[model samples]
Target: MDHRSETGHVMFLSPERVFYAGLLGRPRNRSTGSLLIYVGLGGRLMLTCGGRTQADLAIALIPPFVEHTIASDARSSLCFTVEPESVTPAALDLLARRAADQGPALAERICAAYVRLREGGCGPGFTTEELDTIVLGAPLARRRLDLRIAEAVARLNDFSGPAATAADCAAAARLSQSRFLHLFKQQTGTSFRAFRAHKRARHLLHFVNEDLNFAHLAQDIGYPDSTHFCHSIRRFYGLKPGAIFSGSRDLRIYRGAAQAEATAVAALA
Candidate 1:
């Protein structure tokens, strides 16, 4: 039975990862602050960047916040989003090697791991460690995010009911606006504005499979209107909210992380 048909609920995959697996339409261009690894199950996955077809891949790794398009005949895929600040040098090296290799060993490992999860129908949420092991060829020590930047990112993720400004993050991070702006980019590998926007846009995941009013959900996620919401989300996820909703009618979402555990414990209480 479809879980969404009953409650349209959301579940955690891990603290740093959340994904929807099921039928999905071809994605439009999008980018995000986390590394995106995808496996096109049941069909070929094509990745395009800079107006050229970069890879016709079954499994692939895309670095954080890089613009790209996904085209596939596959009805379903597994998308893993790892917080970039937590990415290891080894992992980065592996991603780079895999990105340049047509038949990288890393891709095969990632594909195999994703197949297991996909065959399990999106349950058994994966740990960030498992994701690391699959893509990096070994478990690498998690790189720590800059404390100030991490605080700011957490503040942004804490609440979507209100809009947060760059100044707010700068203040929360306890840095001069100018310094915060510079350091944020240097630390997070994305601009402050884009990072906040992507974080807000990422929250849009919780409601993707819901039948709520787009305009209302837009505001709930701090977008000024439906247009901005659609555009911003597409800018990151490469698909519009409506298109995603339609395609993921029976979608299975799994979230992961320490955050997910806390949410579970709270619910039980």
Candidate 2:
């Protein structure tokens, strides 16, 4: 492994999606809402989930809300996450099975794409579709969801504002609370509360490169207090709030270009 490759890390973050190429910090159990694909950059990675541990794996896929831990023989890895709501369940399941005993062919392609991304000086402008095509050979099919559920999904992605509640979204969608909750799970394969929690924790990525106080940062991102904030971060990321911040100090972070532009335009409005 080239020593220089391990020194620089970058993260690409968009709404409900993330591509992180960096350190594989100390392994700890984490259950996340997004489907995860981890590829070891230097060599095979070890994976443990569902009472089974697999080694010598070039790639591994973990479904949403499945508690799992991963570690690699190398210093860095390429991790990509997809929001389950954006793809059909069947598509996700097929990928998960393929990754369980995945070989090096597809893994090699993904690693090569990462090299191209780094060498091309690609910034926030990169789209998820582009990433899918480059690495997966094609864009994963999109899920056609109910309009009402889609409306609620849009609100959930805006984690920087007040947390959206089931009641609030149900009312907005002209449905009763119970019915909305049922429909949400049926359509998205996760409960509203669980999805919201993941989004809130994921939103912290936007601040990884910023210097800020933890307590204030917690409040700004819709957490009730710093304790709850720290707990949630650890649950989903396997790292404490302070540790995440400190570790990402030198990492290059980029938000989706369209998202960044939208935020800027809203600010100037």
Cα lDDT tens digits for candidate 1, 1-269: 67653432233355466543455466677778777767665576888877878456776677877888877776566565676666666766766676567444555655566555555534454576665555445654666778988777666665323677889878887888999989888876778887787778877775565688989988877888899888887777777788877765555556555555544664576
- For model 2, give the 10-residue run with minimal summed lDDT: 1-10
Root-mean-square deviation of Cα positions for candidate 2 versus the true structure, in angstroms = 3.1
Candidate with best lDDT: 2
lDDT of 2: 0.83
Report the Cα lDDT for residue 5, model 2: 45
Span of ten consecutive residues with least summed lDDT in model 1 = 5-14
Clashes of 2: 0
For each candidate in the order shown, give its overall lDDT on alpha carbons.
0.66, 0.83
The C-alpha stretches of model 2 lying farther than 4 A from their native spots are 1-7, 100-102, 265-269
How do all models score by TM-score?
0.80, 0.91
